[model samples]
Target: MKILHLFNELKFSGAEIMYVSAAPLFQKLGCKLTVANTSLQLGEYTPAFKTAGYTIIHQYIPHALLRQWKMRKELIQLIKEGGYDVVHIHRSDLRWIMSYCAWRTRCKAVYTTHSVFRSHWYSYPLHFMQRWTAYHLFHCTFQTISDSVDANERNYYHTQTTLIYNWYGSTRFYPATKEEKKQTRLELNIPQDALVIISVGGCSHIKRHHDVIKAMPTILKKYPKAIYLHLGEGNTLEEEKVLAKSLNLNQNVRFYGNQKDVRNFLIASDIYVMPSKFEGISLTTIEAMACNIPAILYNVPGLRDFNKEKECALLIPESTEVLAKSIIELYENPKQQSTLIQNGKEFVDAYFNMEKNARKIFELYTKR
Candidate 1:
């Protein structure tokens, strides 16, 4: 089968990573997979897609209505000429273009709504008009990454028929050996006795990287030798760095902006934490778990869905003192920490094995 996947940006987000990881699996199954990004921004994940040896097409569509129509024609022409059997969409923007093109070409359409989507007050009228009227595309298979996001989407957007969990590529995200960890840590100039914590997400208010930086002082009160590593880059990177400096955590916090081998940093770290205000089964959480790191996350919607609370992670509230104590507690309690690590590994192996989950997606593509 020939499949064409669409996205607004090819950035290092959950949806993009899932598409990049699954494309190879689909190809291995004797299917042709091509990626199309409509965003004007050439995203960071584009190189990763090229490295994986898949064709990537850029349409460069923004919010202009006339431009959208032109892009819709471009999508239809591409799908027809490529003889694509399925057009899978992972991004929300320009989705109407994807849907209309697929409908025109008679290609099976699939859309997976990642939870990063939220309606703005200014765009309510336009959104309401689309949702209430028959103008919105509905003749397609719909999916979401988590139950909570699925519920919210179904109530507001469209009905989702499947719940596909986010899966991490096993080749990149896996447990490191003793020697491998030692070498990675040594290269980073990190001391063996220091407590290393990793939090990866693009710098943004929603991701709450600043919250983690603020929580660092309290964490340092107990574990003074703690090192908090921040990964990912975005518009808010300067704000987070400024906040960290203001809180006197400049020494304790190391901000690495968008590393290609993020899994290496995950393997080098002792624990993974993400206090984001939102997510749809965050791909980082899955990758951290797959790398055998005990994850500590807030009890937000997406995290709550994945939490066995004490089993997979130390799922806590958005409190600095509580987060600090949880880190110290997880460190001191070897038995509990080991249990969390084992359980995380089990969870990743069972639910997030890339090959297994990608096969499920391939099956979805072959339907109808």
Candidate 2:
């Protein structure tokens, strides 16, 4: 089968990561795969696909209204000429437009909702339009892939949706030995004895990185050796840095803009922290768990599914004081730390195994 995957941007987001990881699996199953990324700048993962012998087509679509319309015309032309059997779209904004274009060509169109809930003010209107377009355009056989049953229901309760757990390639992100961790710390100039808390994601308000910085003072009261590493980059980086400096944590907090190899930093860290205001499902959290790093995340919908209190991780309300307390409690109790780490590794290995997830996704595509 020939498959074409569509994404709004080729950035280092969860949806883009999923496509990059799953592309090789499609090749292994003897299917031809092609990626159509609307962004002009192909992200770090684009070369990986090229190396794996998959074709990636970059469709430059400006955010301007007139330019987007032109891009849609070009997208339709590409779909017609490509002769793909399945056209799968990963982002919602592309869904309605792509579905309409696919209808013109009479191709099978499938969409996957990477985010579970809509937090934006325009989400409800966009979702309503998506549902309408799905029913009118295409073959009226629109299907969605969601991370959890709750997520599936939250987005497409009345539509056809399947729950497929998000996965991390274990080979890419795994726990390091003591020696490996020490070497990584030395390379990054991180103190070996310091309590390292690494948070990997874009510096967005939804990620609540500011909240993590707010809790830093409290965490330092107990573990003065604590250091917070903010990985990845976005618009909020400057504002967050300012906030950290104002809180007198500029020296303790390090912002590593964006690293291609995040596993090295993950291995050097003692804990992973995410105080997201909302999440569809978090790939960073799963990656940290795969590395056997216990996580301290806010009690949000998708996060709550993984970090059950007293189980694999420590879940706290979206308060800096509560997050500080959880971090201190975990740091003070070694037995609890060991248990959380062990449980986290086991849970991730069983459920978020990339191989298993790849097979399931292939099955979904091949099913009649």
Candidate 3:
């Protein structure tokens, strides 16, 4: 079957990474996968998509209403001509555009809501219009990667969505050997005895990287040799670095930009923390857990869902003081750390095998 996955711009983010890991399985299912970049410029992960055996194409739609209409016509025409059976949209921004185009071409439309987000009150009209177009006109199938996203969409748009949990690459991310961990730390110049805390994702305001940095001062007071490894990069990266420098945390913090192999870093770390304001379901957090690293996440919507099934990670309120205390407490208590690690590993093993979850998605494509 021909499937076109639509994205605003491919980045080293959860959806992109997940799809890359699942590409081989999809191809094995006799699926021809194509990725369409709808943004003005093709993004950084374009090469990765190419490597994953995706047919890459640009279907740029301008921001202007008239130009968007024109481009919509072109996209619809292309979809009909190409005879794509499914247009699976991973980018929320392109939901209306892709849904309209796919529906016009009589192709099945599937959109994955990657986060629990809705616009401001002023934009409610626009949101409702898009919802009407997608649900009523296009008959698009909506998929939510987490319970939070499903609940949020139901509450806001009144749309019942299929809840498909995001899966991690189990073979790629697993517990590291003691010797491998030591070698990895040695390579990264991290002290073997130091308290290593890592958060892996793009630097953004919603990620609340600054909140973690704010907590570092208190954590340093107790564990003087504590280290923070900031992985991934974004617009707020420089700001996070500035905050780290201002707090005199240059010695304690290492800001590493987008990484190709997060497994190595995950292996080298002692703990994982994601203070994200929200998430559909954090891929990094699951990966860290699969690697047998304990996690401390904020008690926000997406992160809180992790606590629902079982206490996979230590969930604390969105406070710098609580964060610092939790980190130190988790550090000092090895037994609790082990419990969290074991629970996390069990959780991921039970629900997050990519092969199993990816087949569910492939089945969605085969649906009438």
Candidate 4:
């Protein structure tokens, strides 16, 4: 089968990361996979795909009306001439337009919603059009990253939307060895006695890296040697830095912007917290749990799907005190930490296997 994966940008976002991880699985199953990314610059994961021997198509599409029209024409031409069996969109924004183009060629189209809820002004209208007109344009089939997202889209599109959990690089992101953990901590300049709390993903307002920084003072009052590492860079990196400075957490809060490999950091950390405003089965949260690190996340959409209760993880409300208190409690209680480690790893290994979930996508593709 010939498949074209249309991504909005080439950044190492959750959806893009999933594509990078799942492309090999699809190829291993005898499907021809091509990644076409619409972004001004080549994405971080572009090289990874190229190194893995996959064809990557990068086209710069400007926001100007005329340039967008030109890009859309080119996209349609690529799908039509490439003779792709399916055109899958990783971002929801362009699904309507792509669906229309697919319709012109009579090609089957599929869309994956990287976000569970609509947040932007553009998304509000785009989502409305998708939910209402998908049958006519998008063929009414959708893929969501979580159960909550699947239900939300099913209620709106009333089509055959399915849940395909975001696959992680479990082989690389597994639990750290004793020597590996010590080396990573030493590399990061963390003392053996210090408590390291980490969060991996883009640093954005939606991700609420600021809230993690806000809760740092409280965490430090109890564990002064505690260091909060916010890995990954975004527009909000400076904003979070300013907030950290104002809160006098400059020493405690450390921002490592845009890391290509976060496995070492994940394995080295004592705790992983994803204090996001919202999510759709966060890749970082899964990666953390795969590393046997106790995760603390809010009872939000994405994280909730992972059985992120007290058994597997420390689920809490989106309060600074609540997050800090949860962290302190978990840090102080070794027994509870061990339970979370054991159960969270079990949950992740059982439910979030990348190969198994990638097969589900292939099944969705062939179902049509």
Q: For each candidate, give its TM-score against the true structure.
A: 0.90, 0.89, 0.96, 0.91
Global lDDT scores for all candidate models = 0.79, 0.78, 0.89, 0.79
Across residues 205-274, which tens digit of lDDT does each residue of candidate 1 receive? 7888877787788888888889999998988999988888888888999989988788889988988998
Best by lDDT: 3
Instruction: State, as a TM-score between 0 and 1, how close model 3 is to the true structure.
Output: 0.96
For model 2, residues 1-368, the per-residue Cα lDDT tens digits are: 88888776667777677667776777888779888777777766677666656689987656554465567777788888898777887766666677777777877777776665543665666566666767555643444333443445445545556667778887799889999999999998988899888899988988889988998998898778799999988779999999999999977899988787989989999889889876767888889988989888888767877854337878888898888888878877889888888998888887787878878777766765
RMSD (CA, Å), each prediction: 2.6, 2.8, 1.4, 2.6
lDDT of 3 by residue, 202-285 (tens): 889999899889999999998899999999888899989999999999999998898998989989888899999899899999
Better of 1 and 3 by lDDT: 3
TM match of model 2 to true structure: 0.89
Model 4's number of clashes is 2
lDDT winner, 2 or 4? 4
Model 3, C-alpha of 154: deviation from truth (Å):
1.5
lDDT of 2: 0.78
**What residue pairs clash in candidate 2, if any at all?**
none
Question: Pick by TM-score: which candidate is best?
Answer: 3
CA error at residue 250 for candidate 3, angstroms = 1.5
In model 3, the runs with Cα more than 4 Å from the true position are 63-67
